[model samples]
Target: MRLTHFRHSCVLVEMSDTRVLFDPGTFSQGFEGLTGLDAIVVTHQHPDHIDPVRIGALVDANPDAQLFADPTTAAARGDRWIAAVPGHDYGIGNLIARAVGGVHAVIHPDMPTIDNTSILLGDEERIGRFYHPGDALFVPDVPVDVLGLPVNAPWCRISETIDFFRAVSPTVAVPIHDELLSPEGAAIYLARLTDMRPDGADLLRWEAEATQEF
Candidate 1:
């Protein structure tokens, strides 16, 4: 599979002549005017994960693209947006997309937690399994090949992130949800994750707008 990192949590996955885009949010770029998308997935209602200002145009451009989002976001968006319920499977071209993680991480005691639907995509044989957990540290029971790891977030600490990484134990770890970090700051997080990574596991540095094979 080939994966392209746009910005922050946005990623484009292409495999078996199918293209799927995830999290076209406010912090993301280079996703505008994209065509031939098989599906567009949003993990939550937050503007950082799904931009209200630009999503309409994106949908307009890809009218045939299947829209998937968290229950709250799907209900509010329209009929075209299907709710990504946990344990349910949706076919996307040659792959199956399954939703997991029902709730977002707790920001604080006073703030209400929202829905976060982390997705797992794989083929029929379950090869090339890729997991993308939007704003949550959801560890799947199944084995994963590639993991989109959120390196920084307000609700989580570095220790928590490390633990989640160890739990998932993917073959490859790709950092996402890192719009808040500077180059040096991101390097710090990456270094720690690399040091604490599972034995023989690889951590990748994906360049924006460039597709890297996993």
Candidate 2:
């Protein structure tokens, strides 16, 4: 699979001639050039994670592309797209996705109402997973190959980020929701992870302009 990181939480996953775009948001770029999108996976309804207008444009461009999002997010759009329920699995083309529930933050315990989700992709064996935790901080029970975590997630401290990595134990960890910091800040965070936990995980500091294969 090929992964391209745009600004903020947006990521483009290419597999088997199908492109799956996750968390299409306002800060994201390069959507204009995307083709053959099998589906769009949205984790929540936050402005940074889900831009309704931009998503509408994407749907307009790719009429055949299905949308998989949380119930609230899907209701907000009020369109004929598929709604992704927590703990349910759905398939689109070669991608199979399962939603894992998580908390957005510790402060507002019940306001968000399970808006965050961790999506699991791939088949039963030799699965390649992509997790977008949104603004959540908990690790699910499932295994993950590539974990997309919010590095400096709003309302959570740096310690929360560290604890999340330790729990998830993914092979490759990519930092997301970090538009407020510089590229060097992301590097420093990864470096600290190396020193703190040598056996922890590999941090994939995604550059907006670069493309990566997993």
Which candidate wins on TM-score?
Answer: 1
- After superposition, which runs of candidate 1 have C-alpha atoms over 4 Å from their true positions? none
Question: lDDT (CA) for every model shown?
Answer: 0.91, 0.74
Which pairs of residues collide in model 1? none
Candidate 2 regions with alpha-carbon error over 4 angstroms: 107-114, 126-128, 197-200
Which candidate's lDDT is highest? 1
Let me know the TM-score candidate 2 reaches against the reference structure.
0.89
Measured with C-alpha atoms, the lDDT of residue 153 in candidate 2 is 56
Cα shift from native, residue 148, model 2 (Å)? 0.8
lDDT of 1 by residue, 1-214 (tens): 9899889999999988889999999999999989889999999999989999999999999989999999999999987999999888899988899899889999898999999999999987873388999989988888999999999999889999999999999999899998899999999999999999888678897767767896
**All candidates: CA RMSD (Å):** 1.1, 2.1
TM-score of 1: 0.97
Q: Cα RMSD for candidate 1?
A: 1.1
